[model samples]
Target: MNWDRLQEKLSILSDAAKYDVSCSSSGSKRTNKGGLGNASFSGICHTYTPDGRCVSLLKILLTNHCIYDCLYCVSRKSNAEVKRTAFSVGEVVSLTMNFYRRNYIEGLFLSSGVMKSPDYTMERLTKIAKKLREEERFHGYIHLKTIPGASPELIHEAGLYADRLSVNIELPTQKGLELLAPDKNHKEMVKPMDEIKQGIVQYKDDKKNKLVKSMKFAPAGQSSQMIIGATQESDLDIVKTATALYKKFDLKRVYYSGYVPVLSDEKLPALNTSVPLVRENRLYQTDWLMRFYEFEPYEIVNADFPNLDLEIDPKLAWALRNREHFPVDVNTADYHMILRIPGIGVRGAKKIIVARRYGRLTYEKLRKLGIAMNRAKYFIHCGKYYVSNDYDSLQLRNLILHSGKSKYTKQFDGQLSLF
Candidate 1:
């Protein structure tokens, strides 16, 4: 291997892969079979896992050369300014093994631009993964980005080795694709997603029926990403698209990437415009509500409110809008109803339910159960302690905002919350 050339390729391709945010390695329990490494169910990305383990992965692209001219993409074919580089299959496998041995990364996240064709690009990706698993005997996590128009045979081979697969939709709506990337459409993207979903289901069914003792097809399940603020699509549109994808494809995750202006185009946001980080964070919070809090898409966002409130979270926003559901008696409310309160999380609600079996929960006891009394006080009541229900929606919103700010100022000396 040419050391200088390999270093150059790594510098460019690794930087290019930063734009893709769907690189998470959770839900895979690929154990070490007398192999090199193991993939825990806790996950191993550049983020903290559920058990507070900070794991990292070697996220990089195979190549930056492409055949499509996506206006929003920095690695598009029409952009002649970007320095292009491609990594041979051997080089990628070597880099992953060397990195894992050196304690630099726990796994590999490989994506690429459409090199000669979709099949050509996907073939190289699958080959790299195959080499790592079969030849190198690597059991660590492997996440491969599936090309939209790639052949199903190649994708199937990829699933045999990879722990997780992802296909980025790029944009929320078909109209956005038409405007920014005329060559791509939602149909082609959905095809690969459906294929991966079916593959996972088939493996599960076969294992359940005792037809096969050992079979692994993308054991971590599949996920996708959509670009926010790239085109004219409301939050409602994004939420509905995500909800449909989860329902139809059984996706494990749907990531939201705020658009960063890399190229100037008539159809794209300006270079000086700020990235919609707040909107993207709000959308992720809304996704959490839908997944964990049992919130329906229409309940969080509808035609009446097309965009999320940048100031507050989706759960609190919903509680404020429908005041009739407030003043919930925590002592008697069920799990789902208590979950609707602004300050009560899923764990807190479960704890409340378990703790109430002994005696009536007072305000202090409820606080001890880890409920945020600053916001929950206005919407819930315990035994003998009831917050006055005289404040209207507007007044309640202002009060909550004020109290939250004051508490932050007092606790942390006026430092704002990052989220």
Candidate 2:
């Protein structure tokens, strides 16, 4: 019917879509002329229904016709060659509602180009979300991009309607922001994050006050995406920054999106070379360890092994590197100590902790407990019996890789190995 509107929608949305750094779509770094064929981390963009199960969201932008020429972005003012689009806020709301009703998507991830100003753009976004929550009664997940410099009032309001709100920190450091996105300063980004954090905390403390037009502001909590490979920020640097963000901001998740050279900017890195998919993957692995696995950033990525290993995960690599700490007696190790063992996850480790109260856990009980025995065997002993006679680092490393029993393999996700 209205093909012009449809086309406009596509251009605006796809261009806006480029700014999101959440999906760990790797393909940035390539083999240095004499390396592997390809390696990139991949994750699906998630949408969810009212029932709370995850589905695909029509992850798109309202427009890519951005006023601010962030050098890292395809929609930057300087990149005039690329087509731009911005869907009407009403259009976006309708699309999300219709799509959800028809079972096309579980939710909407609506981001936009900063058209007039952060205030203007954020206001439009706020309108879309408000309409969805109040008029439509749509319970699907809504992830809105919080403009970095948007006012505290706008951001505070955003947290009320949006399931999760994010302000893309864009780059890791202040200098990186200055180099890549000129209009976006580091403080502008961090300020919104800080405000959102405070608002969320306030809502949590005042959850009972429903009449105040507030539920837990961003109950899912705030998340941000950092562009990997856009600048020369090392994996260690990126992760270290994430560690600080987590500690300082109480962020729910710090997503790492591999940079793709969609726009041919002189300041940006070359594209079409394999984006560092493996490296991106490894970073997520390390992030998981930091958040859930009880490992610190310093413990995993340090001087000698500055970059994560391409072949093995960070945890397996760490275990191989530090063989002196292996074969932990499963029956007696504390919960924190149990997590350090490769095969045991938080749930599995918790099970081990709970099951042990009944009796001493044996290797057989561990198998039934769904511990990652393949990875676990290298680090854990059961019932006072150490599995390995000696810990030769090289041989132990190889054994652990090949040690995956079918059950262990099924339970363990390679991407999750670093954790």
Measured over all alpha carbons after superposition, the RMSD of each candidate to the real structure, in angstroms, is 5.3, 10.5
lDDT of 1 by residue, 141-196 (tens): 99999999999999998999999999999999999899889999999999999999
For 1-419, candidate 2 gives per-residue lDDT tens digits of 47677766765565467546553222122122342122122222344322233436667877676789776677777786877667787778778777777767665677888888889999989999888777777666677889987888999888877767887888888777787777778777889989989987887667666566545477667788787777776677888789888888898789777776666644344543435677778888999999899898888987766777878888888877776776687887788888888767899989999999999997678889888776676577675335544436776666556753222211112322221
Q: Find the candidate with the highest lDDT and give its number.
A: 1
Query: Highest TM-score: which candidate?
Result: 1
In model 2, what is the error at residue 287, expressed in angstroms? 1.3
Candidate 1 deviant stretches above 4 angstroms:
46-55, 266-272, 404-419
